[model samples]
Target chain A: MIHDFLIYFLLIVLIYTIIVMSFNLAVGFTGLVNLGHMVFFGIGAYASALLALSGAPWYLAVPSSALIAALSGAIIAALTVRLKGDYFQIVTLGLVFIAVTLSRNWISLTRGALGLPGVPPIFKDSLHYMIFVMAVFALSVIFFYWLTNSGTGKIFQAIRDDETASSVLGKNTYFYKILSITISTFFAGLAGSLFVHYIKFVDPTIFDLEFFVLILSMLIAGGLASIQGSIAGVFTLGIFVELIRFIDRVPLLSTVLAQHPELIGASRTMVYSVIVIYLLIFRPRGIFGRVEV
Target chain B: MPSILPQLIINGLIAGSIYALAAAGFALVYYVLKFQYFSHGAIMSIAAYSFFAFLNLMGMNYLFSGALTVIISILATLLTNFLIYNPLRKRRATSNIKLIVSVVLLIFATALLQAIFGSSTKSITLGQNKVFDFGTFTITSIQLSIIIIAIIIFLALWFILKKTRLGKAMRALADNKEVAQVVGISPEKIYTYTFIIAGMVAAVGGILLGLEQNLYPRMGIPIIVKGFVSSVVGGLGSVPGSIIGGLFIGLAENIGVLYFPTGYKDIISFVIMLLFLLLRPQGILGVKARDS
Candidate 1:
């Protein structure tokens, strides 16, 4: 039982690491603060959930969900690319609200907050299937990591550093910005589909502001631009949150803190906030953040 | 048809007035600080909850409770500036860090409010819900009060901005922080005063909002979105533009709901904001340089 729990926890962390790494692509590489990153995640989950419920196979549903999320991300970027700096932030923030509303209210398609349940696990009958899933996720992460370290990665970094300078150098900066956002959204969506299948339930709450903040905190805390840093951050934070459950089990601590079992939950978030603040104050570059663009 | 239209206009003006009051406070901080005041919503929420707590628990009258809340909010605003903004300003924090800090403070303030208020809606009955028939239309007493208060606030702010020495210093600072400091305008003093005034205005707006809609912990979220939209539509950093933009948004949201579901009201404002950012990113009245 303990082994099963640890495996589940580790798998969840691995999935989120991919999501946060994708987020770092848009935020860290493009200098675009896509506050609505969860919108794509939700899109992926919803698409996969709907497909599986309608008797679609897992292989087809996953890629289709990713494509849909990528399309959505590209559309959002295209529509609001003219906005600069803070205005762009506000626009993305607004987009998140719109996305959440659609997810919650579009009852005909999304079931409107009743949520999608009974999603099929990717490999339900065997432990070997879990290993395969982990292998696939790891391979995708490795591929992206290598891609980001290549010449294209430098182009992305240049676009982030100075869009005008890059454009002046004939880089077609807008196309690259759109490209990076779409690619990021695609992987985020892929992760979302995997998550829904694993949990076998999906809800609008999964894509709310709190989750967005969690992903952001992970990305920032882990190290902004690096794939390895994001993975480390997600695992560290995810395991830390899971470990808080043990706080209530500790005999002495429980007796001293009897009046508030929920203190563990609250303090868990508080610790995350403090970590973010401390990181921002002491090392804005983040732990393992790349020094040179 | 004409008579009912006039009444709708009147109602829209009243709602717009409240928004203008809120947006002006928001605009002041944005103008001087060069970033959106994320915690302004929290200040509004805190003031509403604090006022409700005092009125219900301490047996204070409505007006007295409001005044006390205003005072407390100002103090809290000052403290927030000291704790959050002042240290960053001293360090010459990056714009990105400032933005992130604002969001962090917003989340922290929201959590703190939830911890205290327990996620429940709180309302204060001021006994001012009576409706007055004005010819072909009717208006509530509370609505009328909101309008009168909004106008009074706007006019007062106009006078201060146009005539007061401190207000001139504020405008100077907003225009060019370095230049203003070179000419001896203290950025710290101006920032403190800006936050205090913004907090007081937001508190009053919050009280008025509580009167209109029951006060819930998450009420500030939508208001902040709408307030930001209004500020952007009117042109960021422009005081009068904020008022006009806020009124236009109130009218559009209120009247636009007649054609579509009220849930889409926020979407309408958001779409307009997107269009503005795309076509006229500087906003209708904002200066070109302010786009940065």
Candidate 2:
């Protein structure tokens, strides 16, 4: 029983690791503060699910959904390149609101919050699925690690440090910013696809603020601009958040919570909010942050 | 369908006044501080809840409840600045860090409100409202008061900004912090004054919002988003711009429901904001573009 729990826990952590790594790429590495990264994840989840449910193969749906998300990212990046940092952040945040509204309102495609269930799993067996996810996680880590160390990665950092300086060096900073976001969003979309298949459900709640807050907390805790930090952040916060479930096991508190069950969810949110506030104020750079905000 | 046009316009104006009230205060803090003070929404929530408590829970009269609510909100705002923002400023935190902290405080405030209030919707039952009809359009007393109060506040704000010593200091600081400091303007003092005024203004907006809509812990999120859209549409840091932007968005959103589903109303403002951002990033007031 413990072994099964551990495997599932690791699988969930790996999925989040991919998402946070992609988030770090855009925000920490590229310095875009892309608040709408969740839109890519949601889009990818929906795209992958609809395709797979309509009889498409796993290999085809996953990458195709990722590419679709990347294409949307490229378009958004292009349209928003002229904006400065804060403006860009707000516009992207607006995209999240738009995505949620559409997912809820466009009942035909998204089913309007009822969610699409019965997604075909790539591996029915839990152990095999864990191995497959583990392989994907390893490949993602290696790819991101290599990409961030390459010459192009150096340019990404340079652009992040100072866009004007990068442009003065005859580099098209806009194109590079778009490229960074595109690559980051592609991975985010892939993680989303994997998540939906594993959970066997896709819903508008997938675009909830809680998920964004969770991903953001992980990114901040691990510190920015490092792949290892991304992984560490995800594992640390993922375990901490998951451990909230054990609160029910407490002797006296469980009885009190049993009388008012709503407090459970509210308490979790409060913990997240308080932790984020404390971290941002007291430790802005986080545990392994390479670049200072 | 006997042209619900006038009614929509009236509804739009009423909504615009509330939004303008919220956006104006938000724009003031953003102008002086040079960062998005997102906890403005939290202030609104706090004031609304306090007003609800004073009027409903404690059985106080309207005027007394409002006065007490404003005082409490100002205290809350100052406490937030003292506890969170002041420390960050002393440490020389960047704008991004400040913005993140503000966003987190908003979430924290929301969670706190939910924990206390039990996530149930509350209304500030002000008894029965008196309705005044003028041919095609009908206005409730509360709605009329909201518009009148908004106009009064804007005028008062204009007076303070244009005719007061503190306002001059604030403008000077916003124009150039170092130069203002050299001239002995005291940016920190100006920041305090800015928060005070922002708190008072947004608190009234909150009271009005509670009277108009059903109060929920998450009510602040949508209100803040609309105010934010107003801020951007009117130009990020411009005072008058936010007012115009608020009205414009209010009108557009209300009129948009004529053709599109009501669920898509927020989308209209968002799209307009995007268009304004991409094409006229300077906004309608043509404020000098900051930072490329």
Candidate 3:
């Protein structure tokens, strides 16, 4: 039973690692600060949930989810790509509000706030299923790591560092930005789809403020602009949250803090906030952070 | 049909006035700080709650409570800048780091307010709900007071910005921070004054909004968005632009409910904001090349 729980915990950590790495693609590599990155994840989860419920195969649902998110990313990029710095951040923030509003109000598709539950697992009651999911996640991480180290990755870094300089050097900064955003959102969607199947429940709240903060915390903690750092960051933070939940099961701690388990969740958030703050204060460059600014 | 249009317009104007007042402090901060202050929303909410607490618990009269709230808010605003923003600025933190810090502070402050206030909506029943009837229109006393207060505040702000030495220093700081420093003006002192002014104006707006509607812990969220949209739509650093943009949003939102569901009323402003960012990123009254 302990082993089973551990596997579940590790699986969750693995899934979040994928999600965080995908987010780092845009925020860390490109310095986009796309606050609405969770929209793609939420969209992917919703799309895959609906698709799977309608008898589509899991394999088909995953890629299709990425495709949908990529399309959305492209549209968003096209609309607000020209906005620089803080304006881009606010625009993305607005996108998050709009996405959540749509997810809540669009009753016909998202089932409103009721959420899509009982999503089918990938394989029937086998530990190997978890391994398979982990394998897929690992493969994607490798692919992303390779992608970020390639010539295209250097171009993205150049664009992020100085768009004007990159443009002066004959790089199409806008096109590269769009490409980076598209790729980032695509994997984020993929992770979302996988997450829905693993948890067997998906909701609009998954796209809310808490998730946004969590993704951001992971990216910041792991060291922005480093793929390996983001994965470590997500795993570390995800497991930390899970550990807090487990600790809440302890009779002594529970009795002392009897009135508020909400405090536990809040404490976890506070921990992340403190870590980010400490990082900013002590090592503003981050744990594995590469970019200077 | 014809008569109701006038009433709608009047209502829009009243609502728009509230937004304009709220956006003033936000605009001032943006103009001076050159970055978004997410905590502005929490501060507004805190001021509203403070006013409510004073009136309900301490038995203070409405006018006295308003003054107390404004004073407390200004002090808090000044302290927040000193404790949070100034330290970060002195370290020369990146804009993204500053933004994240602001957002974290917003969330933490919001949660703190929720813990203290228990997340309930607090209403101020001042017993001043009398309505005045004109030839073809009617208005509440509260609404009339809000309009008067907004005008008074706007004029005061205008006077301060135009005539006061501190206001001139603020303008110089806003124009060019490094240059202002070269001229021997301390950015820290100017920022402190700016924050105090912002807090005072926002608290006044919050008090009026609470009186007009009801005060809730979460009330500042929507107002913050509306104010930001208004600030952006008018021009980030332009006080007059924020007023015009805020009024435009108020009118558009009130009138938009006629065509769309009430649930999507907020979306109209956000969409307009998004469109503004896309098409004319400078805002309605902003200079074309402004970095906002």
Candidate 4:
């Protein structure tokens, strides 16, 4: 039983690590506050789920969903890159709502809030699936580490620090920004694909604000602009998010929680919010983060 | 379709008034602080719940609960400025950083509210609210009050901004902070006043919105989005523009339901905001260009 739980936990942590690292490319390195990252995740989940349900192979569904997300990411980036920073943030944030509304209202395609379940798995058993996900996670870490350390990563940071200065240096800042977002979203979509196959379900609730906040807290706490930070953030917040469940084991809190079950979710959000607020105020760079908020 | 058009317009006007009230406060803070005050909706949520507790739990009369809630809202806003925003400003944080902090605060507020009140929806009144019928359309008493009170508030705000000393100082600061400082206007003082005024107006908005609809922890998100849309549509930092933008969105969304599902009503406002941002970031009354 303990081994099974551990496997599930590790799988979740690995999945989150990929998503947060990709998210960091756009937000931490490129300095784009793209709150619409979840939209890509949702799109990937829905696409993969639909394809898998239609009897497509896991390999085919995963890549196809990721490609679809990447295409949308590039389009979104191209449309909004010209916006000033704050406007860009708000517009991207607005896209989350638009995407959620679309997913909910377009019932014929997505199944709406009813969700699409019973997605086919890549591996037969949890153990094999964990090993497969671990391989994917390792590859993602190596790829992200290489990208962030490369010359292109340097340009992303340069654009983030000052777009005009980078543009004056003759680099196409717009193209670079779009490139960063597209790549970031590709990975986000990939994570979503993996997540759906593992959970074997996809729903509009995947785009909940609570989940977004959870991912954001991970990014902030782990620190931005560092692969190490993203890993550290994923584990730290992921563990805490799961760890809070054990609060039910504590004698006093268990009774209170039993009486009011909803408090558990509420408390988790409160704790993360407090941690994030404190970090942003006093330690804007975050625990593992090099970039200041 | 034509028969329902008048009703939709009336409904739009009612919603517009509330959005205008909320947008005015949001725009006021944004104009002065030069950041998206994302917590404005959180403050609205807080005030709405406070009004709810006062009216329902404590069994206070309407006027008394409203008055008390306004004072509480003002204190809450002032405290947020003193505790959170003021410190960030002192550290010379960038607007993006502040915006991030505000978003976190918003999430915190929602979580805290949920923890205290639970996730269930609550309404101000228990039974069916009173309504009056016109020939073409029917109007609820609460909706009528919302419009009347909004017009009154707008007139009051116009008078204050145009005629009062405080309003002039606020305008001066928003126009050029350094120039206002050079002339002897204190920004700290104006910021405090801005928060207080914003808090008071937001309290009124919260009460009316709660009375018109149901109150839930997440209600703040959608309302704030609408208010943000209104502010963007009218002009980011312009007060009168927010009011106009609010009404326009309200009308558009309601009328848009004619062709789309009712669930898509919110998308109408969001689309308008995007169109405005892309095509004309300056908005109707805004003089500043988008590049800024």
Best by lDDT: 2
* Tens-digit lDDT track of model 2 for A203-284: 8888876678778878988998988999999998888888877766678978987888888787777777777777777887
lDDT of 1 by residue, B1-292 (tens): 3546767777778778777766787787888788777677778778878888888868898879999999988998898788767777776666666666666666666666665666667787776488898787798988889888888888888887889998899999988888999999998888888888888888888787777778876677667767778888888777778888889888877777667776566677777877887888777786453444
Question: Per-residue alpha-carbon lDDT of model 1 for A212-285, expressed as tens digits?
Answer: 77787778777767888888888877887687657667788687547755455544555555556556666666
DockQ of 4: 0.56
Candidate 1, DockQ to 2 decimals? 0.35
TM-score of chain B of each: 0.94, 0.98, 0.94, 0.96
Residues forming the 10-long window of minimal summed lDDT in candidate 2 chain A: A269-278
Task: Calculate model 2's interface RMSD in Å.
Answer: 2.0
Ranking by lDDT: 2, 4, 3, 1
lDDT of 4 by residue, A1-293 (tens): 99999999999999999899999999999998898998998889999999999999998999999998999999999999889736787789889989888888889998788999889889989889999989999999999989988999999999988899999999999999999999999999999999999999988899987788778878888888988998998898788878777766778888998898888887777777776776667777777777765
- lDDT-wise, the better of 1 and 2 is 2
Error of 4 at B179 (Å): 3.8
How well is each residue in A228-265 modelled by candidate 3, as lDDT tens digits? 88877887777766766654567876775467644554
Candidate 3 regions with alpha-carbon error over 4 angstroms: A1-5, A124-129, A239-275, B1-3, B133-138, B288-292
Q: Report the C-alpha lDDT of model 3 over B69-127, residue by residue, as the tens digit.
A: 99988888887777777777878877677767766765666555665666567788776
Best by DockQ: 2
Please state the error at residue B179 of candidate 3 in Å.
2.0
Say which docking band candidate 3 falls in: acceptable
- Superposed by TM-score, candidate 4 places the C-alpha of residue B281 at a distance from the truth, in angstroms, of 1.4
